[model samples]
Target: MNTASPTRKPSRIQKRNRKLILDAALEVFSTHGYRGATLDQIATCAGLSKPNILYYFTGKEEIHITLLNGLMDTWLAPMREIDPEGDPLEEILRYVHRKLEMSREFPRESRLFANEIIQGAPRIGPHLEAGLKPLVDETSTLFEGWMAAGKLAQMDARHLIFSIWATTQHYADFAAQVRVLMGEADVEGGARAHLDMMFRRLLRP
Candidate 1:
């Protein structure tokens, strides 16, 4: 029995309302996390009634999933820009810089994504497997090629990628701790310089 709902294109108002709901949902979900957030909270944040929020999204899970799916592209775009034709060291350092920039500029999105991963990614696990894994695998292959050519230090490509992720995201994910530890100093610029230096030393041929 095929009982799925038919899909229809959204009208102009529908588009605007959907964006409003999603923007509100991001704020709520990012602050409260998936398990802690509620439809009423999202509605209140959006300045829409609970019913109106539900009209745009059937439930909290749908909104969270939509946000994750949409943000994944932006999150992974830096790695996707690592060109094989470019200098290996420069390409990697550029990617690291872009990631650090993202952590500084999009801390909320980073935290939201981190929260999902910390909770075992119950909603996004499938998406990670189907979408993220292939991109990572391709990047890993590129890393191996660079290593084989003696352009990069011989290290585990996967671990190198993981280190980059952890180091860059730590500033954003632990912003409060970082702020307190660093006081009122320029944390972003300092971290950016430190990461650049660290990766350069680590990746040097």
Candidate 2:
């Protein structure tokens, strides 16, 4: 007999609590990976009761999914910024620089995503198919166009993109190994210079 009413927007407190939970969850997920992370750990990190954390997110899986879903835009923005009309080498190098900067600044987010993918992305597979695949396809097409015009070296565009991702993300994903190998040198600056030089040489026509 009664009709369902519309849902109200979250209050300021609710928004703040949600952010706190997400921040805590990112730290936990990045450190422990999805399988190792626990709700109690997240609740303690967020300074919320288990029930309160559950009030914001249904469970650990939901929290992990929410954190990852939110990260997709930020993660893919460099790819999205690739301009077809701009100078091809410059555009690609700029995208590389932005990605390296993201690695330095948001390593936690980077590791969280890397962990999800390493585990076969069971939670995020659908989102990747729906959101990530199209972007990669579009970028690959642009790379192919540049190759056809002799603006870039002839190569598989998708593999080129994959190479860029692997090279740039290695700094974040294997940061500990890099530190151990590099000793006390300037890691970030050195990586930036190395990546810029490598891509410029690789992409030059």
Give the alpha carbon lDDT tens digit for every residue of 1-205 in model 2. 1112257677788889999999999999999999899989998999999999988776788889989999999999989999999999999999999999999899999999999999899999999999999999999999999999999988898998888899888999999999999999999999899999999999988
- Write candidate 1's Cα lDDT for 1-205 as tens digits: 1112467666788788888888888887887799898898888888889988777776778889999999999999999999999999999999999999999989989999999999999999999999999999999999999999999999999999999999999998999899889999999889989999999999999
Candidate 1 C-alpha error for residue 168, in Å: 0.5
Model 2 is weakest, by summed lDDT over 10 consecutive residues, at 1-10
Lowest lDDT 10-mer window, candidate 1? Answer: 1-10
- lDDT of each candidate versus the true structure: 0.91, 0.91
Candidate 2 — which residues are off by over 4 angstroms?
1-6
Error of 1 at 68 (Å): 0.9
